[model samples]
Target: MSVSDFLAFTKKNKNISPKIRLYLIDKDKHYFINAGTLKNGFSPKLTIANNRDSVLSAFSKMAFLFDELIRLRIVGHSNESDSSELLYLLNLVPINRKIRTFLDWKVFGPEFTRDMSRLFEVRNDTVHCISLDEVTYHPKSKVSLSSMSGFKKFRTDFQKAWKTLLEIYVTEQEKLDFKKLSMG
Candidate 1:
């Protein structure tokens, strides 16, 4: 929806509490300096906030699954090793450290893991109030779809990595955890 329409809707909806006042900027002042769009080649949508939420949600899930794969593959090693043990060890290591350890081990080639790195970049960009996402205005705000530039490649990369992890790491379909997924 256009900024004007969004403003109209916000005013109409009594339940909607806006964090910031909604106003229209001069169309000329609206600009997006999106290097992520060039890098990921993903376009932003007209419905900015929903698109952002969806992308964030998908990336969050993939990042979580990636971390789980690390725990099961690196720490758990086998079904008999104990799920509690896997989670306990996982509790000790931060996600960044885990990814670095996985890379250091070279269990999977960088080709498969590059996206993992990108996930961090994208996540950092999203989480840490970086430009693009930070510069990005609220939905229905008078700005281009700026924050969404980093998300285009995230889902695809995550899916590919998750697929490879399943193919290589999964040992059982029924249980689907350290017990079934252990490399040992």
Candidate 2:
């Protein structure tokens, strides 16, 4: 819809208070160019350019872009549907196999892959668990990340994952574009 149409809707929909409407409009504009798609904030261009977008939001975007990487033939084989394919490969493929495959490809370095693996572990913990049990003691569990400082570290890890994934996505996109042009 046009800007005038949106403004008229905002006027009629009093439930969408001025602040809420403005925030939604700004959010849609910030991530997606148009609100006509009604994606509910589901765009694959989920890179953390600035602090405006939360780390979790970017992580969600990165997850969606995994399919893009698969489509581009960058991460996994398109034909391997059973388990080798990128589709839900994170849950199906063993960690060792994942490391082996990633090591073979130079798009990401060994150390970075290691870090990304750890990040995913944390992400899984955060996603799978229903709620975090309260920790009373000072020294928190090192592995589970049940404390505030641990949660902070999780955020840092997600930020790194988002940035690293964005770099890989851009590099692969350029390579694909060059290949298509050369082929043409």
Candidate 3:
């Protein structure tokens, strides 16, 4: 449904609690706003000086979606993160055979790992200025604009990473379903 339609439905729907309704509205708003912004930016009239903003926007959405997939796979529910909490949790997951296989076969080889590494670096250093590295450098005094080429790489990497995570989630879910059926 469209954002307006969703809003209208939410206004009439009384079964959902205020908190849930608000969350749903916010989720729709994120999609609506992102789609609109991307559409506007893609037009010939709009001169996008740098791709940093667009790349960051795509990376943010991809990261959130990746985190949500992880939450759903592990906890049977989804949660959003505003900081590095999800990244920390992801790091904590043991890189066992199953995960390794998933990353290799289900995803596109080591590209998932590479993309995620780039995404994390860009997210921390380029976007937030919060270094997740062991050797952190002092913040630059001047604002640095990201190169168009770098943004192109970021956009492509984010897409691969997001797609890999989604495929992993789907495969894991199928495995869960098989186990349930076998047990039943």
Candidate 4:
């Protein structure tokens, strides 16, 4: 079964909450999983890590999925050596311009666009493992299990960002479906 179909099955049969399904099994599961996985077919799984590392990995995965969508749409291909480079290029254009023209971003408002931009920056920093004042490190460079205030804040922000992205994607799909119906 396709990943989306598998996810839908899980959502329906496993008693997983809709909130959990949306976060862990995105509607675009097939695209995201295929684009983000390595040759070994291993994709990042959200596990029980310290809050900071967990949030960082979650945000990075979110950003990567969005980048993969953009790459497919704009470049008409998915074999790019790196996705971060594509995101950096896309971010060079004004956020307003992007929100006006892109397939997904066209449905976003100014506030959503601004938040997404900020989230992208955070994703970049996190993926690079840049040391942040808010992140307390263990002696072996592992994330400290200790609770951190910034990690809490980041988790909240990541939820907001992912929600916004999912909403925009759904909006775009609705528009396409309506167009198809109208034409038929």
Q: List candidate 1 stretches off by more than 4 Å.
A: 1-50, 74-82, 130-132, 135-151, 171-184
Model 1 accuracy (lDDT, Cα): 0.42
Better of 1 and 4 by TM-score: 4
TM-score of each: 0.44, 0.49, 0.41, 0.45
Expressed as tens digits, the lDDT of each residue in 1-184 for candidate 2 is 4333444454454233211111112222322112222224344244433222243455555555554554455432123343234456565655445545655776668877776666655445445444443211112235334556655555566666666765675555444332222221
Among all windows of 10 consecutive residues in model 1, the one with the lowest summed lDDT is: 32-41
lDDT of 4 by residue, 52-130 (tens): 4665767555655454445545543223444446667876764434544553545566666666665555545555664
The residue ranges of model 2 lying beyond 4 angstroms of the native Cα positions read 1-60, 74-100, 134-144, 178-184
Candidate whose TM-score is highest: 2
Model 2: residue 22 alpha-carbon error in angstroms: 30
Candidate 4, residue 110: lDDT: 66
Flag the better candidate by TM-score, 2 or 4. Answer: 2
Among residues 3 or more apart in sequence or in different chains, the pairs in candidate 2 whose N, CA or C atoms overlap within 3 Å are: none
Clashing residue pair totals per candidate (backbone < 3 A): 1, 0, 0, 0
lDDT scores in order? 0.42, 0.44, 0.39, 0.45
lDDT of 3 by residue, 1-184 (tens): 4334544443354222211101111221322112112111111112222344654565455554444445444543222242235447665653343235445554435755544654555555546543222212222222233444444444454555555555554444443332221221
**Where in model 4 is the C-alpha error above 4 Å?**
1-53, 71-105, 128-147, 175-184
